[model samples]
Target: MTAVHASSESPSETRKFLVLLVGSIGVVYGDIGTSPLYAFREALRPFSDDGVQQQEVIGLISLMVWTLTIIVTFKYVLFLLRADNDGEGGTLSLLALLMKQTGSYMPILFFAGLIGSALFIGDAMITPALSVMSALEGMKLVTPAFTNYVLPLSAAVMVGLFAIQRKGTGAVAKFFGPITVVWFLAMAWGGLIHIGDDWTILQALNPINALWFITHAGWAGLIVLGAVFLTVTGAEALYADLGHFGRKPISVAWFMLVFPALALNYLGQGALVLGHPETIHSPFYLLYPDWALLPMVILATMATIIASQAVITGAFSLARQAVHLGFLPRLLITFTSETNTGQIYVPAVNILLFVGVIVLIFSFGNSESLATAYGISVTGAMVVTTLMSFQYLRSVWGWNTLAAAAVLLPLLVLESVFLAANLFKIHDGGWVPVLLALAIMVIMWTWTRGSRILREKTARNELPLESFIRSFEKSAHPPATVPGMAVFLTSHGDTTPAVLLHNIKHNHVLHQKNVILTVRTSDKPYVSDDHRATITPISDRFSKLELCFGFMEQPNVSKALAICKKRTELKFEIMNTSFYIGRRTLIADPNSDLPRWQDRLYIALSGLGIDPSDHFRLPANRVVEIGEQVAV
Candidate 1:
């Protein structure tokens, strides 16, 4: 399985794992958990000056429910979740699978991966604002005191939530499940209190209201699609995280706990809108009595914090995969715990999220306005996922006519409506994510373009192992100062490796003995320490080293060096060994197969990315970078 893990546990530990798993799931699932606060309310609100229509409310909810049922329940649960490469799932893994299947067309698949990853960046940027803003918007309904102070308060709360992420969420997430449970129960209880008067609105359970609203309302009814888009905002997380809780547990949680809580809360909101009319302005907060509003506001705030955790966690996981697939430059990734499969933190993403979310809160101010940026990225992602699924059926599954059709029916049906609905929202500030997605797409394309060019140039210079071994001993070079060995990192199995070429070109030396270590990461999550490193003897002066790693394996050059020290007779010490890496000059390469625009993109990637000297598992003092000339 490509799924990530700590170890195989005993039966008792497995039981304990269940308890921890549910709790962690709650913390990671906050985005979808708290949608009831604003998803339905916005759906019913007026677009221009016409005001809320009872028919529109029913139509919107119906679409929302079915979207969840088809998109989340069927497409993800029954199909995409099973398409995992090894046990990992994401744009990178998906790209890996596509490349493996379509060898000659790898660049096309990589381009798709670039676009998909770019859309994910846009999603990452918007999720914090939409989720936190949705939660705090309730503060206004609970009490008008929060009006002017809301921006500062929300920013402070979000900053605190993000800052402490390094400490890990294992302890706090234990309460996440229970607290979310209480919030859902509160939603259900409040909704049940008034679901009685709205028995007629129950007619919305039928598809006719949805059909009629679209037919009667014409272009305006089209806008409701964007508003209804809020209900299933986190559905992408369902697919992205399917490997974590497994398809069964998450599906179970959605139906048993999350689904019911949301349905009841939404119905209650509809009931209030129909019965009290006045309270419909903010049905979510109005559900609480005046005396209890303060407490409810606190609960809502907590829910928003939980919701932000999912996106934050997702950003970490997605970023990790991006690095693994070589779509991004290596960044620092830190595991938050030794046990939990889900706990992780990324320094760069954390800072970016904190600053971006706060800026969004201050700019958008309320859920109603921020909602404009929310659905476009989401729908865009959904559209790509659906398109990828069809490709999966043809290329990955090798399905014929009947099976492919059966698989694609719901994916197309559900995503079409979502894509259609989100289209109307463009005028309502929904264009933000589209612009964001395009900008990100450009950046992602640039990084991948630069990386591929460098990889190809390095590959071209690779010498055969036997030839390299013989020539190294003969070439004019500095003799070894000591008997110790140096290990170089290479991505390819066979090539004129970069570090070795750079070492000889600059240092002008050959070691008495050396190992060319090529690190190869399997699609799976963890590899056993025994299978981690393979030694290939080339000659008396050189050896070929292949270090096979899983996603969960720590890439520690020093530690691995020590292991070699213990296993081999050759001396391997941090002090005696020098690490060499290649640095490229980003001159535009228009002659390359990639578009001329991509040449510019590579320059940006070079600027943003860590140098090979830093990314390699070598000490700063011992490391050296040799700059290579290139023409783009």
Candidate 2:
């Protein structure tokens, strides 16, 4: 998972800045960098046979150029990057910031974030299939003999990409910057060589051409916008990876290298189509000499694989955020990098994504077909982000309604148009992503709802902590006191944990020192170590401990308790401590508000979660679980 952690570190020195800038290009720009492979060809598909006219070619290229300029360069790099949450940015991070400024329990805001996250998963599944297929499609230019091998070869490349995820990217990550720098330089060189062929192609630089195309071409123009939307598809990554590389490094990389390279390449492709027309079928590859074709194909394949890696890493991060925020059940999360906590691997997410990509490769069979399924999810996500940004601007940034609308409305309007254009692709394979997003949304919503119901049902039977402690003090028959420390994990700090109640009732003894521990996930990407834990003495033998973690952090109860011991009066030996946890067996109640099927689904999902002791990093030898049945 690639969600960034907050830090108090200052900006890097000049030497360090140069290194981070290159690394940023490799990871942050991979997705947008590879778009030149398929975005242009697919955009002109509706006019393929007729031999696209000069004006239309210029207009489409104009749209491509300015789309990169406006949406990516201006909107993302300049505007949205500034909306970061404590130096971290992404849908979840942004949502977390908004929730902190407001409250954690807003239904409308949560629903919007859930939908955006679901759409991102859909985008994640499609990116690898589309990018790899498009790169391999260049093989036909090498020889017609390679055409039959494209799908199989694409599938293999994707399998290889996902297969390496478990091992982590740290080893090869260093080379990514240098290799991607070469890729961008190659793109710029390829376009510069072709631009001289038809100097008039420079006319596309004028915004008037793009405006004219949109206004005059009617429905075809609208459809073209959807295709053009592909150019900025992965723009979200710039914000998502803000914590990985600071704002300055990513911004410098884009403005200094990435943006210029993409623009030149698109213009070169346009010039090639204008001068040769026949090359439109494979303009990106044919821009190089015959001897360069093989090397170019190799380079393109590598670039696309990197692009896929970015999306997959993003999926891991998003899943962790969802789980931390109570929208999804706990799943296994493994840290892939010893030095970087943000570098993580989620096996379940990896398997699901690999399966989804393989199925897409077989079902769609080609880049053009996969392209139909791509734009909608990304555009949908963009729209959701814009809506959330508006809320942030108004509430967090302290902008008035008019001020917020003034800044956000134009972007929203543009994205809405792009969304409307992509909507026309529903029957032509777009339904694939829609269905994927819908399925994920259902899972998230069900898990969230079921969790709420379970908490409420348990809360009704929960004994208040103070009352229980007072009653025990005044009891005629007090339990025997054992010499040790007991730690009980609970959801509610105000109430006695069921595990504690059950433990004393069954064992007929109370430990000399008791700690009521409640672990909380805060609505932020990272919480500083200084503020991670809070301890309050409730009575002579009892203390209340609240361990707070950021949504991007994994909760480790033992480590947190150790930190508390170092900083506070609390002290306990590891060998003498006992960790008590509650386990619930849920039963479907016909009288409950939820439908019967949903209740069953909730139970099934709850069972799939990881063992609580392992999730909390508790010592298994000292842990005891008390199970009880509850109806929901």
Candidate 3:
């Protein structure tokens, strides 16, 4: 029986692995996969005005191919994936891992993570507008009539996309794999048939050609280099989506399918442009015959929409991570999939992205114009990721300074060059992302600084838990004791909860059984059931219960309490229990630690947070919220 079971399980495991590999190709590679739609054409556009040269074609393609090789294939797929925080990856995940490993909060690393996250959110807004516009622009080649409808159509598609986010991705995710596979195969075929147009285009495979182009092209070369950076714009998704599909599957999909398809398609574009330079305006679409042009355009539209969906979902995930880490206020998060914890919807983030996309579509009006704004956020994010990776290598992996610098410095130099190249577009449209990132960074900084001051101020005035409990128990005329259990939620376990103190003063009674509950977010992505809850007895009538949740997890207090009941001596029937929570009314104080403007901003930010009852998933009927006014 053991031998038969082992043999059967092997095939099942193999099938599951294959499924993951395909899924990763669909979701993980979507953004980068759609780059061929615009990357080559845009890179070649600046030179086309003077009549394109053969070396420029080969050189640009060479620059693009090598960028994919280094940034996406080497830096992200191989290096960053290994830095997962309990199987999770991304800027914040890496930050959490570093803090855990170093056993302290490193301010520089914290700000690096914040910058990466803010830039990513800015990228999220641009990607949908850029990708969708580029794809739909192909229709102009199908018929000049499409020139007018492109912007409106792009806006409509995006509006519809955001509308359906609440419905979840699970139902549509199965189709994503098959549709993307077809897209890749179609791209490879399009590129393969055209490679013979100029076999010399193969010279782009040599990194030396990239160097030759960069050196000879002069100042204009930097502008062209900015366009080349577009090819690798979506590379960070590979690292950001690491937890969804794991490292092996993502790497496998990249090496086996994604890279090859991208290389073939780009080489094909280079070859087509070399043989017939006039096709420069619409080289990607021109690769196909007239009969197939419209169909390819339709297919490209689907692929870009898929790409946009992946980015929008990533923004939601990042926002939730920020909330858990206390970088942002509690956002209204909706679980879109019952089986997939990662499939979430943040209404605010979705609306923000939608508004941003619409604004870009109208403001820029075309992919060529939007391209100027595109690379700043992506390159900025890459630079920040590189800095954080250096810290991770030195601190967590314990690499010698020289060894870590040797590996990261070159990448940093390359990324810095790209960042500087993109900066040239600031007047054109690049300021959109730079401005957006700065706005987000300011919000993050204000929240963190204000929250710290508020916490310090609150902590100073609160009574310690042990002292308050001991004094209450020994009081000559103690308050009357009630019959049921009461759970008072607190941020500091060592201090008495304001809600508990208020209840004793107002209700003039204490529960027969009382518990102080504190929920904490761990540095890891998940906490196992064995380490989920820690209980400590304070007295016969009172105990301290602390529930620990991972940053990636949703804290459901009732469910965790049920687990505690089964695993420990703690006993509480949900129907007979009361959950006491403090609802603070923050008022700005001119004399407080923060300036008046900052105090008001913090107060405004606090109002944006969801109620603790809803955020903690407490029973609505049993929740008792005690209001307290506090000056910040």
Error of 2 at 437 (Å): 0.9
Candidate numbers, best lDDT first, in rank order: 3, 2, 1
- Candidate 2 structure quality by residue, lDDT tens digits, 65-175: 998888888778998899988888888888888887776447878888889999999999999999999988888988999999999999889878889999998888888
Candidate 3 structure, TM-score to reference: 0.99
Q: What lDDT, from 0 to 1, does candidate 1 have?
A: 0.70
Look at candidate 2 and give me any clashing residue pairs. none
> Residue-wise lDDT of candidate 3 within 1-632, one digit each (tens)?
99999998999999999999888888889999999998888888788889888988999899999999999989999899998998999998998888877744488888888899999999999999999999999999889998999999999999999999999888998888888989999999999999999999999999999999989999889998889999998898999999999999999999988999999999999999889978988889999999999999999999999999989989999999999998998888989888999999998889889999999999998999999899999999999999989889988889998999999999999999999999999999999999999888888888999999989999988999999989997899999988899999999998999999999899999999999999999988899889999999999988999999999998889889999989999898998899999999998888988878878888998988898999999999999999999988
Better of 2 and 3 by TM-score: 3
Q: List the residue pairs that clash in candidate 3.
A: none
Q: Which ten residues in a row have the lowest lDDT in candidate 2?
A: 1-10
TM-score of each: 0.88, 0.97, 0.99
Q: Top model by lDDT, which number?
A: 3
